[model samples]
Target: MAWAGGQVNNPTQADAMKSRLQAIEQDLSKNWEKRDELNRTAERASTELKEIQERGIGLARSLYRYSAKADSLQTRLQQMQERERSKSAAMARRQGQLAATLSALQRMARMPAATLVAIPQPPQNTIRSAILLRATVPKLKDEATRLADELRTLKALRANIAGDSKSLAKTMADLEKERLSLSFLTAKKMRLLEKTRSAEHSAATRTARLSARAGNMRELLWALLKQKQSPELRGEDFEPPPAAGKPETATAEPPTPPRQTAALAPFRLPRGPIPALGRIVTAFGAKMPNGTLSKGVYISTRPSAPVVAPTKGRVMFAGVFRGYGNLVILELPNKDHVLISGMAKISAEIGDEVLAGEPLGEMAPSTSSLPKLYFELRRQGRPINPLPPKAARRNKVRG
Candidate 1:
């Protein structure tokens, strides 16, 4: 519509607005066409990678929420663990006190006393009298120990669940960003289509160019979506050189402690019957369920089977571990720390000295059927692949 007198009509502004609207439509159309191509390409990628990509995307969406929940759960578990530990300490103190008191009382009883007051005995043939003093004392101690152990295990499982949850949560932010980008790309695609339909191109040449641009935009969008769905992509274009003054180098890790040569520690030997176990289900080099490789060997065994210490050392740590389940850390003189996981029982107490072949612990009977002895050889805190030699590699000749 033409403007009347005195109304300075700006047709150029109208044209510009029309042009922008046309561009938006064109971009959206292009995205729509290319998204299908991307999906096909993603389907062709390695199933493992595809799975990881899907997981990563899904994780990105839920990570933040999970992290908070995990952290809270972990806090609760930690509090419970502290309580359990306190309870255990108290129990141990009581056991020590009882042993000392009983020993003292027995020694006094043995010595002739100047004054003797006969305490009233139970009625003859009473069932309570049948309880043997020796059996009763040991049973009471065993019950206390079992209670402490159960609490420890529960704490460990809680921590592990929290750890897994935190890892899951960390991925949430990334997924959300991707989702938004996807939405933007989608909207852009729709706009492109709208542009293609509404553009008032008269000449055949102009129409062809607009169509080509629309096609390119579509391809770009499709490529982006594909990139998200598949981890593999051409890096040459995306790889940027280090910016000026920002040096980049490989990050270094902490060094492990050397082996100590002190005298060996001593502790109690296992009385339970030991049984043979089976092959390792997962190994140090074995690929984890995720893309990353594992850091230790998971020896499959019956749950009740004894977890023997491969070498003599002191029980440095004994507690529940996440992912690893019940764990015992043995500190060898060689500075090699052997971590035993998935135990039904931890016979060797934490800080207790123990000899080689000593039973560290055993798994539960139910667990024995699906038993896994996750062993890790670590130097200090750094993980060392246990599949290879604790001894130096030697060359061998072939026939």
Candidate 2:
């Protein structure tokens, strides 16, 4: 009877164990599905971020091109003003010459021909006077012809100036529209970035704080790496509470590239368009008004000039830092980096691969009439004078 009871208990135990195994398998499958869904959501967010970034860049480029057009129009208007001044002076001189010539003709007409010629001292003198009068008639005719031509030219110049003024006004209006569009796009991009960063922060299972206070970029990077590598607890143990407004579905995303060293390795020299569209206002190492030496050159440009990439590389950082408004740093193929700051807006994003001469951003508006950009080049974390010896010869401010 005891042996029979033992066999019955063994069968019951086996069935119970099978039921527990099935339940465990179901839980494992659900966890895997949840993980996959989270990964897909991250990918979609990344895609959205990239799309917004690219759209912002396109708008910025358009704004820059329009600003350039306005500058060119203004320059042409100035030239027209100068030409008008010169022509006005020439017209005045022609008018005076014409008045004198007409007066001489009228005097000759008032006096009888015989009286005019007879009073001259000798027969030859009278003949000479008559000959001179005949010659004066032709000269007067030529002068009148030249004066008419001058008047026409003056009239044309005035008309051109008026036309140019109108055209410039229209161009400026268009530029204003572009500026507004770019502003809107930039704001949108910033919002998107903020949203993405927030989402990433929330989604991360473990986080590291490098210091009690907010840290610099280097420290932020280190903390981010540490957070990524930290072991995450089981969902039932220490899982993050379900976020409010959780997305329903997620798409898969490519794995993010591993972070590289902060310092770029030096490669080839920059051989593309210079970073800024302006004249060098201050050279590298120049004394500043604040009594400090400048690490970068200051380029003064027309408002909102397009700042382009000087070489092919990936963007390292693209955002404001401290007082360096809208700063962008590009890591070159060989590890050199170029820093462009003083931008009104940034178009690129971190890890974006930018081509040489691609538009990166636009100059910010200045308190003065023209905006200024601060540009620098560094190799292996050390800044060098970016302006080459031949830069002076090659430098040109674009309209």
Query: Cα-based RMSD of the predictions, in order?
Result: 24.2, 12.1
lDDT by residue (tens digit), candidate 2, 1-399: 124644645767777778999999999999999989878977986786666556655654565566656667778889989988988888788788778877876887788967865673888877776678778888788888888888888888889889988988887788778667756665676566565565334322232222222234333333333433553422222222233353322112112211222222211122223575567788766678987666667788777666766666876566666556677877687666688888887776665566655557777666477888888766444455664434534445442
Best by lDDT: 2
What's the distance in Å from true for residue 62, model 2? 3.1
lDDT values for all models: 0.47, 0.62
Model 1, residue 353: displacement in angstroms? 0.9
List of clashing residue pairs for candidate 2 = 40-251, 264-335, 265-334, 265-335
Looking at model 2, report the run of 10 residues with the lowest lDDT sum: 249-258
Which residue runs of candidate 1 sit more than 4 Å off their true CA positions? 1-276, 388-399
Per-residue error at 323 for model 1, in Å?
3.0
